[model samples]
Target: MILELVRFLVFIFFVITSFMIILLVLFQDEQGDGIGGVFGGGSSSIFGARSSSVAIKITAFFITLFLFL
Candidate 1:
């Protein structure tokens, strides 16, 4: 039963992460800056720059984990 619950949670996590990654990738420009410069162009840096750093890493880690799973 515990293993089954773990499997279910992992499945949900994987699906959610995949959806978010797809959304992020789809919304990004070919240059790979992501939907940043579209409207926040005036800023010296891109949107979600600093905070996105960690978020991106975490997303990447999850993606890798999902792939391995």
Candidate 2:
């Protein structure tokens, strides 16, 4: 029973992480001047400079989590 419960929890976590990764990928800017630019494209804007890096890292994290699960 304990093993089955653990498996089910892992499955849930995997599914959640998969969805998060997909969303992060979609939100990421393409060619450094895509959808992400529309919000704060200016170089002076902190988000414009850092969003891509943040998104990429988060996406990678979720992908790794999904794989581990």
Candidate 3:
């Protein structure tokens, strides 16, 4: 039952994240501006635009999680 709950929560999280990703993509500027254009791109971007370690880490975590499930 606990495993099932985790799976269900993960499913909801994925669904919500998918929509958020789509919205963020749509908000980005096509020329060169990122979501930072709408938010703040130049001032606070710790990682560069393309090579974010955070993105890699999050992706790795999700992949491992999915596999474990």
lDDT top scorer: 2
Off by over 4 Å in 1: 32-62
Clashing pairs in 2: none
The weakest ten consecutive residues by lDDT in model 2 span 42-51
How do these models rank on TM-score, best leading? Answer: 2, 1, 3
TM-score of each: 0.49, 0.64, 0.47
- RMSD to native for every prediction? 7.4, 6.9, 8.3
Q: Residue 25 lDDT in model 2?
A: 78
Better of 2 and 3 by TM-score: 2
Model 3 is weakest, by summed lDDT over 10 consecutive residues, at 37-46
Q: Across residues 1-69, which tens digit of lDDT does each residue of candidate 3 receive?
A: 999999999898877666655554455434454556324464324344653435433444454454564
Stretches of candidate 3 exceeding 4 Å from the true structure: 32-46, 49-69
Which has the greatest TM-score?
2
lDDT of 3 at 13: 80
Cα lDDT tens digits for candidate 1, 46-67: 3345433444445566567768
Q: Give the distance in Å from residue 20's predicted Cα in candidate 1 to where it truly belongs.
A: 1.3
